[model samples]
Target: MTSQFEYGSISSLQEIQRLGEIIQQCFGGSPNDWERYLNRIGAENFRVLRQGERAIAGLGIYHMGQWYGGKILSMAGIAAVGVPPEDRGKGIAYELLSRAIEELYQLGVPISVLYPATQALYRKVGYEQGGSFCRWELSVASIWLQERNLSIYPVSPINYTIFEDIYNQQAQVNNGNLVRHRAIWEQVLEPPKEEAIYAYLIGSENEPEGYIIFTQNREKQESAIEIRDWAILTASAAKRLWTFLGDHRSQIGKISWRGSPFDPFLLLLPEQTAKIIDRMNWMLRIIDVPSALSKRGYPMGLEAELHLEVRDDLLAANNGKFCLSVSEGRGEVTKGGKGTFQIDIRSLASLYTGFLTPQQLQLLDRLKATQEDLETARLLFSGSHPWMADFF
Candidate 1:
């Protein structure tokens, strides 16, 4: 942290382009694509660590929300993080990410998520591998289908609202799914590039229970259908959607999902055809500890409280003890009394997302807790394994 090193948004087009060039140099993407992304998200969402007029490192901040423990939590997503090839190993990237976390904490965001190219860099800033992007691949012929009366219709532009409603219902019940904001919806529906994207809805027209968003592609006469997003609420709707996908076997060879580990569609496909083609680890950081814990939904039937001695290096405000209590599906976090368990920020991040169990952390020597505390911690942290479908 030098006096000359400033962290903030780019002020001019020249700076933005220069920053884009540096980002391109590090990220290996075309400048035009970066420009398009900046245009879509807006210039102000990006921040730079600069030495006076020179932008040495940059990161894009997204004001987003994720579902955790069956409820939506405010999340600041970090994207397009980069430093010039010349500036590597100078601590520029660390300062930029640290400042981004600090700013998000000050803005009252509870948690932060990012797709890390490497785990070590993020781990130093209290981030841990939190969730998984489990993409299931299946041959088109293998989708199980039973003949049903449910109708599947292509979603018109007028029916986007129905698609959104169905998604909200599905996301609310799943952990670590994004609560797609209005802007996000608008961004998703933007005109396609190269290949056309399709959206199909099942059930009644006015109130769709299930919908699938995907794209069709072919290379060297081998075609495949890629499922970009989807949600189904009922058995019949799921049958309809899988039957709909099953209908594609004649034209497409394979299907890939942008889904989590707990996808129901996997159950509808033949076990032989269904394979996990890719699993990407996404990292999370608990920026504001109390708020992150209190705001996320917990199981309603459980009752427990723990005195947590947390260690946060980047955010001084979070470096202390706190009492966390959960009851009736809500949490109450207050200042310290007598600390029961001692944990550092990275381990806490893992605990906060239910990515790792307290007992497991204690066994790994990342958490120190008594038997009673471990049992209570397990009950407190039990829920759907945290996973994010969207990568920003």
Candidate 2:
């Protein structure tokens, strides 16, 4: 027989360990493998559903920031949601979601986002559809390696500081870029294994121009190299960087890259058919609609106003409408009374990146606006693919 339990009371490390074991058993591994994950996301951020002495269901929360004019906090992210197989279809997961969302609301987290394994499941919980990421695969032979104007060298501890400086500059302008703290860099770049992350820095005139962090997988006797992070300041630099990767064409059979939906690599490869796979990585919501919208850079020569009615089932302040106006890289916000278009905050975030249009979101029922309002929203929110390179 199944039992009922309260949510959000999993406090101790022991309790978390017990819950982790349940996850491991159901999902096929020991939770100890996620120690780094647990540390990054503290146990206090998790909500657990316990029946008697046994923990059954749980969810994790993480924090992220959007670097605009000012920083927005309390951007909570949900992950590692699971319920035991025996307890499936009993509405346990749904109840846990409700309780977790309520707890996040109480904590004053303005936005809650998740990368749903199934998009339909989260929609029922009031999370809307966001834009997706594209994974591109290209054969090394297909890429024409340009003359190496710059020297490519392996990353070393000595040049870590210079590499970071160059990376930070690229990350700032790159929308959908994750702000990698020092801890994240240490964990990703210097893990404790032979399969540790490999990094390469491109130097021009003794100065760094680009860098890439990647790892090799040798499973199935086939060599597959996955690029974890890649950034170059110029197109020529990008070509030179890929040319370096092409040098390993004989040994490395396949190369995969993940980035914005408008990645230029797709345009570079004309001879071979590059496979593009669309997968949603990050889901963003406007914690402060006016501030979040106004902070992000928009396409030039576009001036318009949008009335956003963001329904924050968790946070009350974000549940109302606000008028947003932008022109010449400046924006203003007013009370959304007497507005032209109405959209939810989640929809607004999806539109923020220009990967998905207001009309497209409207068709998906993610945005609710009239025809004229939809046209206005489409005009203001449209831009090149907006994507964050990292999933924080």
Candidate 3:
């Protein structure tokens, strides 16, 4: 029996254009703009489910890495998922994602992450909420700091490498932040159409401790500042950056940026005036279970063992008993265990990043574990709160 639909890498520009139209139909973006984006991402990075030459569903895959426990783990970033209105009920999205993760596993991508358009569909494929992407808003007038002790300089295109270095240094200490791909950097440095982006380094030229990249939007009587990205390595840097932003109080109404829930920059603020305007939970899937466990960093000097029976309906390789031994700030996985603690792959995704504790998962009825095991699991995965400043 021949299946009605075929799945493969998008083979031609015409198929790419058709996929762009399908995405536009689902996401409400200009087809031409999406077409250009698809071209830039390259046909090789996309997979589609097709009925003959017409694509019914599709998504793009980005090869990237994410930070966890101060280590970089290989990750697949899924984006642009789309299914035409008429094909919504046919299980195309599930089949497409199912095939994608299987391929990712074969390619040694230990994990996958995505910002979902809807959570239910991803849950079916063993993905769960793993971390937060929070949007913070602060009234420009609220920042009254006037510290100019550290010199600030405008960064030219040639000085962009410093920005990359500073960001990686900060990402190392945080969980779930991206080890950004070059494509992401391109988007960061490129100014929007008819708008300008300013990049600056704070502190002395020889030893810059922080950087800020932002764009100003002036709409007649109202104006705002959008922080594209920033990082601070010193106490004075935070105050200096805030002072620079406060300088725009006369013109900029508010400043907004996507960041972690426990952003250290907030600690330097004189008052708690910064409000979280938006919050998003990004999902993660353990594509290759043992590899995922081994690649992630564990808490140093705290050694313990967890016996897990992970259930995965789609990936048989992950559906078995395993022993996770943690030592020297790393984990090693082996087959066969008591299977004392049991959880499906979805619940494990959340626990893997420390986004939710084993206790919380049990409270939600997402897992079955003893109080003793829960405490052991908690110590093994404990770290900074999992959050990302990047979107997709």
Candidate 4:
């Protein structure tokens, strides 16, 4: 282990294959199929930590443009980080992460996010906790069955365009929402060995209003169905969809859904035994201020202008503030004279994801604001708990 190590980019096809092989051996499974994974890394987003001519570690960054409230800009996502078993505990992973993060910063990537394998490691590397996604399980009989005027039909690939349009519209209006790109849709809708997948579209007056994606698992000799993603544009549509799931109570021993932490199901099912098995889902980082704020809907009939000082340890540019003025569901941002409230970019991200409240941030010493300023920040950023069922 005395060999001198050099850190740099790895792009050649042969080199990437070598890195993939090392990752497979380290993780006990193959990484994404070679060609697709490489394409995802693109030409410029892969990094390597090498010992002489041998690649000991590899990391990939996926650039995504997302709207946080209203601002839209490229955000960096760290994925597929791996190091050879022999290289573990040798600081190889840390070396690769540091390099990758710095490169993203240099490239103007304001926010970097990852689903951590170990929370402590990323926290040590300057990442902070954001949101928790709750995976809930309930008996099919848990929901009250109600007759609906809507019709339900199996969802197909042909409906993806409409499904996406509806989902994006809803997600944009909701806080703690992540903009799902086309690539994400493709992956989620077509996971491997997914023959048991099922989908249903709820239609009102012959127009689609909601959709549900689920999969049935019979491998355990128990009838269970897992709802992967579900969205409804109206209360009626939501009721119709739930009724459909409930109608199958005899065939379904248990019904599970991956949903936001604040999903009303828990309240909706009082007598049934329901569990929040998986607590956290997607982590968020604020890549752009104006864009992030503008995309989400705000509480009605409240208007305020506050200067925000956001401290980003990794990306320095997110530290400045523009004034945030909100009236009704509309908001405006302008270059302000000075900020009243002080907080870090991570704190802002936490607030954006509904994982941490302004009050909680204050308690953690992550927020720097006076009483009035704190109230203003709370009014602007506060909402129900945010959760993302999908993991990027």
Candidate 5:
């Protein structure tokens, strides 16, 4: 517990080998996986916490972005947060997180998000649960696909633009969704030799509004379709897509969908043949309060003016009163105002992302506001409950 932890990027193959073994022991990965990962993302993007020459914990910093308030905000997606079993109960994770967040803010990332294995450490570090990554399993026959004049065509990697266009359209209306980097799409279009994924587009050949990518696996004469990524522009298109999924019912016993947290598949099902299989909540932290507020998209018709007293423990620059004025669906955040109520970085993130409304936060004692202020904040921060479809 009293060990002097040194925090920095991994420097050598020996350190990479050591970190990989620790990862295998802690989270299960190949001993040499770190070497390959470092090669892909570069050594500087990965960090480690060491005592002397021994690594105790490590994490990777992914330069990512997410859709929030109708705009894409730069995000630091924390990945591979691992601590050796023997290193647990120590402060290594806290130390590593502190360094990672500081670096993210310095790099001008307005927000940092991650899928937390546990809420305690992240909450203590000023992160809050934002939205869930949900998956559902259903019998292929259960899908009620409404037949329409739908032209669905298979898409080849050569036509990546159509797929990206549809995906981009979906991300816009959904808060906390990812604004994927082109490198990711490049990989998707040209998956590794060991990967099997397929894509398709719907609508006119020149104008595709919906897309789906899926992978299949078989077991003992039964087959399952795992939807990798998909998006639709209309309910009719969605129904048409489901109809396409239903086409495999003769061969596919089940289909698993990892889509919007608010997926209406259940409502679309004529019968109760689907089950909620899994759900995982992703955490988000506000790195720069003013920046996050100003950059996020808001309801264009919403007009409001408010004051807030924000408190940030790790970032002193965010610890002060902020004046938030909104008009014509845009917002401006400044540094002075008679704060109506106070909120910490953690709680503020929840409210800012629409994961929790002002009333809910006040009831939880996370947001301090009266009836009027709460209503104003509610209107100012109103939007869909943020959900991230991507897992970092």
Candidate 6:
């Protein structure tokens, strides 16, 4: 295991095929399946660590944005990090991730987030649990609602812009929802392989209030409805969509969708029959602290100033004291401060999303700050619980 390693982007199809084998071995997908996935995401985004001509570890970077405080912040979604079994426990993951994160910082990405297979390796690179991706399931038979106050109409690829408009309208008010990339949009709007996807508008085409993109999974033995993406901008639209889903109770037994822990749609249910069937916590790494602080939206008309002493072991530029001045729902970061609040970059990810309050991190010994600073930090980052309806 003393051979030299090269770390960089994949340059050839041979490298991709080799990396695809590693991915197939690590994750349980056929190489051709991964090849199609790689093609969809684009080969330019894939990076690898190589020993001679063979790729031992690799990962993919997806360019996207995350909504926070009514604004969209640029974020790199990291995915498909894989390594050969023989290469495990040799610091290969750490090396690949560190190089990839540095590359992101060099490219001026403000932050990077990933759905981690393991936290230890990501944590080593200053990534911490930033938000949640939860899958909720409800028995279709229990929906019991047939309200059709709003008109429902089928939407085709030609009018997919309606989905974007409706989704953005809902996303601006929530935290951590994706401002999806074109690749993600293509994946959502297009049917996969042999399966078919259905898209519909919840209101009239002239002024659509919401949209739903879903698929019906019916096998010989079982059937279920899987919602790919959805947004309800009005109460009537929500009722209509639920009724439409309930209409499928005759063939679909369960309906599952990705949503937040406290998804507002669940509140519309008359009873608590829906349950969280699956959940995954995604991690975030702040690549450029100042850009991250200045780019994200803040509470309007609330003026405040907070001094932070942040520590970043991986990125030197982020390791220092900084002052954040907020006004008109925007922040300006300047170097030098009283350093009243102290935290590491990893913990800041959680605070940045308002996923964890300053006090909670203080209690967990993840950060240290005085009571006054803690309250100020809380207000500076206050918002809905950070969660994503989409998983990268």
Winning model by TM-score? 3
Worst 10 residues of 6 by lDDT: 154-163
Candidate 4 displacement at residue 205 in angstroms: 8.3
Which lDDT values do the candidates have, in the order given?
Answer: 0.82, 0.66, 0.88, 0.69, 0.80, 0.88
* Tens-digit lDDT string for candidate 1 (131-243): 78887888877775864678788866644576777888888877778876554665555545667878988888776778888888875688988777788898888878888
For candidate 6, write residues 25-144 as lDDT tens digits: 888878677977888789999999987877889988899999888888899999889999898998889888888888889999999999988898899999999999999989998888
**Model 2, residue 43: displacement in angstroms?**
3.1
Each model's number of backbone clashes? Answer: 1, 3, 0, 16, 2, 0
Please give the distance, in angstroms, between residue 243's alpha carbon in candidate 4 and its true position after superposition.
1.2
Evaluate residue 293 in candidate 3 and report its C-alpha lDDT on the 0 to 100 scale. Answer: 92
RMSD score of candidate 2 (Å): 4.0
| TM-score for each model | 0.95, 0.81, 0.96, 0.82, 0.91, 0.95
lDDT (tens digit, per residue) of candidate 3 on 273-306: 9999899899999998899998899988988999
Decoy 1 TM-score against native: 0.95
Clashing pairs in 1: 67-176
lDDT of 2: 0.66
Q: 340-390, model 5: which lDDT tens digit per residue?
A: 878899998888888888899888888777788898888877877788666
Query: Which runs of model 1 end up more than 4 angstroms from their true locations?
Result: 158-162, 181-193, 270-272
Deviation (Å) of 105 in candidate 3 = 1.2
Q: Which residues of candidate 3, in runs, are more than 4 Å off?
A: 158-160
